[model samples]
Target: MTLDEFEDTPGDEAAPIDMLEDYFGARGWSCDRGGDDEIVAHVQGSWGKYELRGVWREEDRVLQFLAMPDIRVPDDKRATLYEAIGLVNEQLWLGHFELWANSGILLFRHAALLSGNDGPTLELDQAETLVEAAIDECERFYPVFQFVLWGGKSPREAIDAALIETQGEA
Candidate 1:
């Protein structure tokens, strides 16, 4: 699915990471530019802390962003966590959750391709939305992962519990 928002510009396009940095800075988020094409930002969510990374590939004109929460699945919980990821991803409209194979790190990833007549341009609003989506999805599903890893709950149970809608605060 096309998860990116774009606007047509007449001239040369700045790298996507640069645009992402500006968005993060505007939100007062702590971010570090890894290089010309990469940036990492730290954001706090209600469930946990997050590390958001943006990488721009000039060759392919693609911008990839990842949001990783401050939680890790133990080796024994890997199987269960994978099941929970599938359930969580099914409900998402924009991005999906994944557990890194090597690190067992859970994260949300989405990519936008800046290909067309417009070149590699990304609007500020699009950048902001992209970052917001990542954090928002991560926050929404944090408890599901925790349910499987720590609470010994089944994947379906975790998803059901996490997705329950409450009418008002207690």
Candidate 2:
């Protein structure tokens, strides 16, 4: 389903998971509706591929989204990766990065509180924004992690190098 098709969907009729699944599918992204409340998708970012998972908690009226990059932080690099994650997180306005120590996986997680005065509702546009933000942040900071883990650069140096913005096109 494309955005146009999603737009045609009656907002009140679709659950949060359904909306998210449709949104990802519209972009020709590979995604699976794991269940009534869960959806998983793989999104290709400029840096690499990301696994995006969405879970809708009806009781809590919250929607949680996680974006995991296809990279693992080795044990030797975990300490530096921790420092790098701290530095990178300080510069973000939404969500945060976390390392699953057991699995050595790095992921960005953010949740939306859907419990409003009226009721819990997740608009399609809001879902899109959430997913977009997650991907954008992940892409923006991917190289920083790479610099720290593989390039043997200090946390500060990694942040500084990854953040350099070049003006105009080459």
Candidate 3:
């Protein structure tokens, strides 16, 4: 979606929520109200399924997007996953990629802090950029997780194999 399509306020709602509502809806993904001002977005990627949650913090005035692959990262691979994620997170600009030790869930999390001058206004590109980064990170590193989980490859080996130069028609 373009910047013009994201007006500051879409009706009575803030732009962050509206931008996500329209963005995910346009892709035909089920955008359900996930209670507590959060919209849960579910979509299937090339490697596996994913869940993107957009939570609008009314008090903090921030929109946080949490993206996680459907696959439950095994505990045995957590250390290796952390190693691989360290390399991956270093290259990221927007948010940090993390695996929650408590839940064994790998997540791409980002937050856009909005200004409360007139109202919480979120630019379309700003919201889109966050979501895009989340998805991009998930898609790019999915294979590494699979390698560690199913292929039984070491973290270094998996990252090395996944990061190899892949040339093909886009």
Clashing pairs in 1: none
Give, for candidate 3, the lowest lDDT window spanning 10 residues: 1-10
lDDT of candidate 1 at residue 137, scale 0 to 100: 91
Clash pairs, candidate 2, are: none
State how far residue 39 of model 2 sits from its true place (Å): 0.7
Q: List model 2 lDDT by residue over 101-153, tens digit each.
A: 99999999999888665666678778888899999999999999999988989
* Alpha carbon lDDT at 141, candidate 1: 89
Error of 3 at 23 (Å): 1.6
TM-score of 1: 0.88
RMSD, one per candidate, in order: 5.1, 1.9, 3.4
Residue 75 lDDT (model 1): 89
User: Best by lDDT, which number?
Assistant: 2
User: What's the distance in Å from true for residue 78, model 3?
Assistant: 1.6
lDDT of 1 at 24: 72
RMSD of 2: 1.9
Q: Please list the residue runs of candidate 1 whose C-alpha ends up more than 4 Å from where it truly belongs after superposition.
A: 1-14, 116-118, 168-170
